[model samples]
Target: MKSLPRLSPTSYALLGLLARGPATAYELNNIMQTSMLRVFWPRADSHIYSEPKKLLSHGLVSEEKEKVKGRDRTNFTITAAGRDALAAWLAEPDAATHRNQAEFMLKVILAEGGSPDDIKATLARALETTRTETRMAIAGIQHIIDSPEAGVRKGMPWNGMAANLMADILIARLRWAEYATEAAAAVPDDSDRAAKEDIGLAAYQRALQRLQAELDP
Candidate 1:
């Protein structure tokens, strides 16, 4: 649809925001954390601020100068070029399979001998997040199935598929979290029994650091 380079998902999400309405950085941050971005791309605020510049440089989005309460706030708007680029990206065939990186699992594996209560807290928080995400994902599936364009073959079903997949993943995660929570709560602080279950957390952290170091350098 448009002559455009491959952009990261961060770039697409940013463009999608401007595709809807002109928004300041704060508004973009809210959208990223609250909507589709929350369900998929969990990114930093600084990254969000930097992407508009990249999009603007590529001539895919434009910025409007706006002032709020006497403070200069630049509101970004996606251009026709951006819409075209997004359409092309979506229309393009992407058969490449992606890998999963479960950072939370890494953290959980590393939480050996730390406070069991703290471990419980972490799992509980994850449980709540998983529940919320799964609910939103189900809603997305409903949206896709109800679309008038549902019968046609295109990129729309991908979101519905991903959303369903995420729902399943979240459900599995919640089940794991329950067992993890129970395990953490059941551990005796005076004993190193859990540590003996497998590789102690100290050993795991040391290995993690070495891996991190190797990757960093």
Candidate 2:
């Protein structure tokens, strides 16, 4: 049996989208831009435009061409092999212990190099973004519940579950940002290293307590 090509997470993400239905790359890019994929698995438009061709080369997806307005449009659909590959990827165990939030967290970690206002602004932006995302996620769930047709409703159990997870993470981030923003604002300009360490220790303790509570039955 021929081995499947080693695919990146982005490749699998595209395959998952194709599994839903046939779509032109433009349609897929729009979906990525406007849907939960934007929040969960964002990619650059250039990458989105090009990945379909790679999937086609790997025989994971098939392209159908048609003429619209005398212009060639290509639609991609996942092949049987694509479905098998996706299933296999899903079945593989995820070794990651935590979700990566390096982009924002890195700023948080290195905030001492900047002023307290800088960190506060970072936290404020995170808070706002996560709040918006949380609202969008809830709205998405409500849409799925209220949709008349089965097309949007077809995702059912899995989609709902995934949305719930997304909302949970967003809410967690929102809460963290709120707390961090408040704490950063409270920091005194004259605070010495020991004072800052004390503040950080307190924050760590609070987090530990929260984690312990969560772990409790």
Q: Give the count of colliding residue pairs in each prediction.
A: 0, 0
Q: Point out where model 2 deviates above 4 Å.
A: none
Q: What is the lDDT of residue 5 in candidate 1?
A: 74
lDDT of 2 by residue, 1-217 (tens): 8898999888888888888889999998988887777767778899889999999999999999999999999989999999999999988998856445448889999988998778888888888878877777778778878887877875567877777667777877887888888888889988999998999899899989989998994
Best by lDDT: 2
Each prediction's whole-model lDDT (CA): 0.72, 0.85
Per-candidate TM-scores read 0.62, 0.89
* Range of the 10 consecutive residues with the lowest summed lDDT in candidate 1: 150-159
Candidate 1 lDDT over 1-217, as tens digits, reads: 5457779988987776676677777888877876554656778888887888888889888888877799998888888899988777767788766445667667677776467666677788877877776777667567655766733223444655665666766787778677666666666765667655553575567668978998997
* Candidate 2 structure, TM-score to reference: 0.89
